[model samples]
Target: MKILVVGGYGVGKTTLVGAISEIEPLTTEADVTEASTDQDRTAGTEAKATTTVALDFGRITLLRHGLQLLLFGAPGQPRFWFMWDDLATGALGAVVMADTRRLADCFPIVEYCERLRLPFVVAVNEFDGSFPYLAEEVRDALALTERVPIRTCDAREPASVQAVLITLAEHALALHRAQRPLTH
Candidate 1:
């Protein structure tokens, strides 16, 4: 399965990819300089010293189903959005990571997936402690339809990241089955 992992700046897209990947992930990360910060649209990412300049690539093999997943993570800054289309192309599905502190940052990614009719799951990256909102509350805030699944996880934890992937895989399968015509 080919999947794209995307989210806003400093939302843990790269961390999630690295935690669960069986192989050493390929990342085009660069030091965040003053110039780089100037280009960022949102605030509170000052603590982030490095940013994914191009993309992050990783691979994981699901032992249960013997399925191999190719994960591509997009750069979060708006300036790097040009790469999003290329990364998204031919992807079976996508996972949009969300940070409760800056919830609005995920809007673009959500809209992109919806516009392209790509199956996706919204994973709220719980930082340190849990957010005040429930999954339903986040769904309502993002205006996500019932078809989209909302999950909360700590991206730094391997098990949590793996669970998110599992959820995404199940969602993709259901989407595929629903789209196919019934056969005798």
Candidate 2:
């Protein structure tokens, strides 16, 4: 199944894909140049020297479930959002990576998923020196419904990324089942 990893610029969508992908992840990262200084906001991510200009592609197999997931990391800058519609085609669901330091940056991603009726889970990428907000706190901050799963994770850790992916897969499955009409 195809899944999206989307969030605001510098929120670690690429990092999460690279961490969990069994194969060598494909990334379209470009150096942060002065030309984009005014376009890309770097308030909490000043240390970031590169940004995903297109998308990051990765794949992982859930052996237990016999499912293979195709991950597509969307470019975060608003200027690149034009590619989002194409990337979202045939997507089963998405993981909306969140950064507590720039929590509001993720609002658009969340709204996009909601508008598409896409099942998604918010994975809070725990950055060093950033305040640790509980899952509930994040949901409240994002004004998300209780049904949406919100979990914390370290994008750099493969295990952490895997856990978030599992959460999204399960949530999507549950929603799919609920929507299917029953035949007696």
Candidate 3:
């Protein structure tokens, strides 16, 4: 199954993909150049030196579920948003990474998934020194419906990333089953 990891700039989409991927993840990251200083907002992520220019690719096999997930991390900046449609073409679902400090940054990604009718789960990336907001607070802030699953995660941790992925997979599966036509 193909799953997309998407969010705003510096939201840790690349890190999440790399953390859980069994193989060496392929990243199209480039150093943050001076020219983009005006285009890229670095308020909460001033230390972030690189940005994903295109996408990040990774893969993980879930032995228990007999599934192989092809992970695609979408570029977060608005300039590269044109690539999102292509990345989402065959994706079964998505994990929308969120930074509580810049919660608004993820709004577009969540809207995109909803507009595409793509099942998704919100994974709040818990950065150091960031406020500890409960999952319910995030849901309320995002104006998300109860059906949308939300969880706090550290993108750098494999177990946490795995849990987020599992939530997305289960949510997608449930939606698929619900939409299937009943048969004799």
The global C-alpha lDDT for each of the candidates, from Candidate 1 onward, is 0.91, 0.93, 0.93
The positional error of residue 100 in candidate 2, measured at the CA in angstroms, is 0.5
Q: Give model 1's TM-score versus the native structure.
A: 0.95
* Stretches of model 1 off by over 4 angstroms after superposition: none
What TM-score does each of the candidates earn? 0.95, 0.97, 0.97
What's the distance in Å from true for residue 162, model 3? 0.5
After superposing candidate 3, which stretches have Cα over 4 Å from the reference? Answer: 64-66
Residue-level lDDT tens digits of model 2 in 1-184: 9999999999999999999999999999999988887777778777889999999999999799888999999999999999999999999999999999999898898999999999999999989899999999999999999999998999999999989988998999999999999989
Can you give the lDDT of residue 13 in candidate 2?
95
Error of 2 at 5 (Å): 0.2
Order the candidates by lDDT, highest first: 3, 2, 1
Q: Rank the candidates by TM-score, best first.
A: 3, 2, 1
Which candidate achieves the best lDDT against the true structure? 3
Q: Which of 1 and 2 is ahead in lDDT?
A: 2
Of the pair 1 and 3, which is ahead by lDDT? 3
